[model samples]
Target: MSVSLDPVNIADKLSLIDELWTQRKIAGLNDYEIKLAKLKGEFVWHTHPETDELFVVVSGRLTIRLREGDVVLGPGELYVVPRGVEHCPVAEEETAVMLVEPVGTLNTGDTGGPMTRAAEPL
Candidate 1:
C-alpha cells in the first residue's frame, strides 16, 4: 500500500460527517488512528483499560464527565483521558472533535452498546 502525502484538512473532513457521535478515521500514525466526529449530546460512560484516549476540540464546547470531576474544553483545547479512567463526554451544542487512539479502538471502550461504533475511514 502507498501512503498519501497530502494534508488532511480537519474542517473539510468534519464537514463530510453528517451523523453525531460517529467517528471517521482521517489518518494513521504508527499503530494509532486519528479520527474526527461531531458530538451534540452525552456519550456513554466507559473506560479504556489499555490506552489513553485523546480528545481535541475543534469547535464548540465539550465537557468530559469523570468520577472525580468534569474537564471542560473549548476550541483548540485538548484533554487526554487516562487509561482505565471512566469518562463520558457531553456537548450542549454541535461540537467537532478530534480523537487519537490505538487503531481499532472502539468509541465506546469497555461499554458495548448501540452507541458503540468502529471508526470508519473518511
Candidate 2:
C-alpha cells in the first residue's frame, strides 16, 4: 500500500529544529531524519558506522574536512559522506544546513568527541 502525507512547511519547522539543533524523524519506515544545524567555527572529527550522512547547505557555505581533503558546499548544494569515513564540518561564518540521516545515528561517531551526543527533536 501507498501513503500520502500532507505538505509540511519546512521553513516553519526549520525554526524549531534550529532552536534545538536536533534531529526530527520524517519517515519512520525509511529511517529518515530532517535536521537544521547552525554551525560556526569547526566541529569534531567523527564518523558513522552504519549510515551515510547527507548535508545540504541552506543559507551559507559549509566545509567538510575528510582525511583525504576538504570539500566546500555552497547554498543549495548537497553532499553525502559515506559511512565509516572520518569527517569534520566547519564554517567560518554562521551557516545554516539541513541534514538527512538514518534514525539513531549519532551526530558524532566513534570519535566520541564533545559534540558526539546532542539533543534531538522529538
Ten contiguous residues with the weakest lDDT in model 1: 2-11
Alpha-carbon local distance difference test for all models: 0.97, 0.75
lDDT winner among the candidates? 1
C-alpha lDDT of candidate 2 relative to the true structure = 0.75
lDDT tens readout by residue for model 2, 43-104: 88888988888999888789999999999999999999999889999899877777887667
Best by TM-score: 1
lDDT of 1 by residue, 23-103 (tens): 999998999999999999899999999999999999999999999999999999999999999999999999999999999
lDDT of 1: 0.97
